[model samples]
Target: MNIHSVAPKRPDLDRLLIDSALALFAERTYEGTQMPAVAQHAGVGVGSIYRYFPSKEALGNAAFRYAKRTLLDTLAEALADGGPAGTAREEFARFWRGFTRYASAHPDAFVFLEHQQHDTFLDPESRALADELHRVAADFIERGQHAGAIRDGDAEQLVGLALGAFTGLVKLARPAGGLDALPAEDLDRAEAAVWDLLHRKADR
Candidate 1:
């Protein structure tokens, strides 16, 4: 069998290149990253990358899609577990836990995804996937507004605030070791603080 022909969305070699590329993208950035460097990082030859990714932009989009898809999957799984009866607060907690889970599992990917700008080199599919996740987040906020659990505001702005605060919290933990190294008490308090930013004043 020609493994490459019938392989999954990304074959093993393809995944390796994508991972190496993402690590570089996180460290050196998209424009700074080179195909040869990616190969060296992955312990492969420069030609191997070309066989899988036609160019740096193609490799970048692959990495972005992989990272974004992983995040979307993590969040989706978290919310799916919550089911139809889950309260807005419960759903919100799921999102927090989901994000932390993604960051913990794929620190490089998390950094790669968050640090890059969408308009830079993301292909249509990559941007569409990001937009899909954003819509999911906005839906959560709109639902919370109806439930009177979230504070009134533009859902996009609220999503931005929630994500910005969450991102800052994670960044604060990186230098120390990772989110796991942070005290449970501190992580708990950070989650609560973010919730406070989104919660309705009347929620009490």
Candidate 2:
């Protein structure tokens, strides 16, 4: 009996493969990574990978979706309350903190997500999930704009700017050993700077 030909019977094994793939993808990027490397990293045979994912593209898409879903799930609780009356600023601040914390705690996932741009292998579900996340962010920006809190502009563009800024901050902080490496006061200052960029002049 060839064990390599058999699919992993345990869900945890699937998670292990996904997690291993995420780390490799984060370090080497999608194009640079290979299934054999991922299998080796996961301590599984190459055939085991194919048993779970038909091809390298499929595995990449699966890993991307896993990381994305994990991130969204992490934020769900923090964002559950939604924006209450007269609390747009507070809500945004809470969301920003939650996002930064998650990224810091899960650098591999964050890096993998940040690296996904113009990847043709991403499956339909992955693309849809990405679109949904963007829509959520754009909606938040639109709400802030209407409430006279955020700067007036195209909501999508504003979201891009905000996300770009956050991404850049994470990249810079990576050298310093993640967001948590920064002092609490420093994190606060960074968040304040981000808020200032988003805040309308009238609100400021």
Candidate 3:
């Protein structure tokens, strides 16, 4: 058996190959990247990549899943440090801003994640993971509603709205200046705008 073919069976090789695939996908769009390039970048044989991920799409899915996990972990840390979920609008804004900054700085990673939802190449497991992430977001929205922080609405619908706003803000901030390109005053204003949308005064 070839060393490359055998390597994929090793746990470490799986991570190594996936990391390389993601890096290439980040730099190049899905259609533009090839398995060979990923293999080369990973310092493994092309066959090795195949052993773990049958196709480029599968590889892309794995990369995207990794990125999502990483982003959520970072968000969790920011939220933990900022304050509890009840009344930390400023902290939440700060976390959102930081998350946006991270995404802008890692456009390749972000684009890979955005594309994952539409990619037909993703395996069943990867698709399941993506669906679970969305469900978790919906659950969080429901929790907020229960806490009297959010307006009464379908949690799933509200999640979609919140994500739309989040992504839209990132896009708006991208060209004029990356997330951090905005001055302190501008960021402050943006932060206030976000909190205002999420936390309006309760209707009598």
Candidate 4:
């Protein structure tokens, strides 16, 4: 008769809270989401959320890290499967597909991460995760440049440009049921167009 042991484990509850928070963050901006709302979404008492996250800012940071990590992992898996032997063009295609997969499966996370403002409360670890993604992408762009496959530019800027195109495409598709709603041909066209933005041109 150990009712305490039967209760959701701490890690399970933590994930439940974070998932609930992300869902609300997507619907209402992070600034607008309230603790009670998160508790309601998680199907737990308001006190339970506070038990795991000391403050709303703590929950927000956790949600940001979760969403960002999901994105990074998706990209990593795609690149890993393609392997080092692949050409930059091939790798780029894998990277594009990785983004599509992430966006399709976690559209709410994408909206939460992109639609909310994060200037005020992100902590060091959360900030580092954000920077890590930028650095990893810049490394890829630099390698492509060295191979004469990608255009010569500030690698960070190039990453921003490529992802900016992705962000725009996802936004465009969100109303129609997110990235998955787009036809395969449309996705391919968008992917090719984004590559054209980063790829080297003879005149350039």
Candidate 5:
């Protein structure tokens, strides 16, 4: 039998590699991380990494895309629950809580994504996904504006402001230890601040 033909695809191994890569990348950064380190972290041979990903760059992009998709999927689910129709503040609050929960629970994935946002290793597909995420966020902001709950302004600009605030809060909440170590009250304050920034003056 041809060895190549008989080689089994190990999705478990692939997941392990990606998870390990995310943790290492978050701790050491993309350029500072190596395939050997990832393999060692995953308790696999260095050559095994190439079976799932051709190169370090490929692994980085794959990890980023995976994390981004996971985050987006979580947000989608948070928005899917039947809530008060057209109640933008309630919907936004639910989504924000879900986002922070995910970010805190999966700090490695969140950190990896945050650090790789501008990485050149990201392929066209990854770049497109990033754009899609932004579009989704802008749409959410536009919905609030349409409902007269958000301040009147450019949707994208509003998104940028909200995103900046959330990102800063995430960073501040994240101590040298991790996001899970952040105080619950501090996280609550961060969410309130973001909500206040997005709320219309008339609604306040």
Candidate 6:
């Protein structure tokens, strides 16, 4: 997506800080990654970090937003390239498979995203960014529903349920072997079950 070109003109102090924090947090849990360390890694003064993020929690939320945006951008590109068609279940599974590959290639970023999902005190702007990521998925869901590819139900609810199931599986497998815990074949099997749940009836 040409991050440098698309990003704001102002100094990317916040983004750099968040990227540094994510690297540290992946190596050591979030509790172990301190602000000073993040600042050092970002090559920014500690005061610069505080000027952008008042607290560690705020920094974590910013990292979460960055991770979500990265993932969503990947999904958008995959969909644009005609990755999948027909059903919401099919499309989402395609997007997710691509996402898993990206996550596997960048394990730390994946872990950071997982950590953020459990964090409740994220800043308002960070939460808004997270919500926007979902909006991308929700748009696909809504389109599938309109095309009679998805079952009749609340679009938001379906998206939530699908996301919950997929992430829950990842969370469970992560303990077994981190990002590589579940192989692509295994994930494909799991995706089949999730797809069955969301697919429209034949009579439709």
Which candidate wins on lDDT?
4
| Whole-model Cα lDDT of every candidate shown, in order | 0.87, 0.82, 0.68, 0.89, 0.82, 0.76
> Which residue runs does candidate 4 get wrong by more than 4 Å?
1-11
In model 4, what is the error at residue 160, expressed in angstroms? Answer: 1.1
lDDT of 1 by residue, 1-204 (tens): 656665457548999888888888878888888889999999998999999899888888889989989999999888777476367888888899899999988888988877667587888998899899899999999999999889899999999999999888778888988798888899889989999999898733
| Winner by TM-score between candidate 6 and candidate 5 | 5
Model 3 TM-score on a 0 to 1 scale: 0.70
- For model 4, residues 82-120, the per-residue Cα lDDT tens digits are 357368889888889888899899888888877667978
Record all residue pairs in model 6 with backbone atoms less than 3 Å apart, i.e. clashing.
none
Greater-lDDT candidate between 2 and 6: 2
The Cα error of candidate 3 at residue 143, in Å, is 2.2
Worst 10 residues of 6 by lDDT: 112-121
Order the candidates by lDDT, highest first: 4, 1, 5, 2, 6, 3
Q: Report clash pairs, candidate 4.
A: none
Model 1 bad stretches (over 4 Å)? 1-11
Model 6 over residues 1-204: C-alpha lDDT tens digits? 655756558977777787788899877877788889998889888999999999988888777777777887777776766644655666766777767666666667877776444455577787787788778777877888898888888878987787777767767776687557777788778878877777788983
Q: Which stretches of candidate 2 lie over 4 Å from their true place?
A: 1-11, 81-85
The TM-score obtained by model 5 is 0.86
| Candidate 2 positional error at 10, Å | 2.2
Clashing residue pairs for model 3: none
Pairs in clash, predicted candidate 5: none
lDDT of 6 at 196: 73
Q: What's model 4's TM-score? A: 0.91
Residue 141 CA displacement from its true place in model 2, Å: 0.7
* Candidate 3, poorest ten consecutive residues by summed lDDT: 2-11
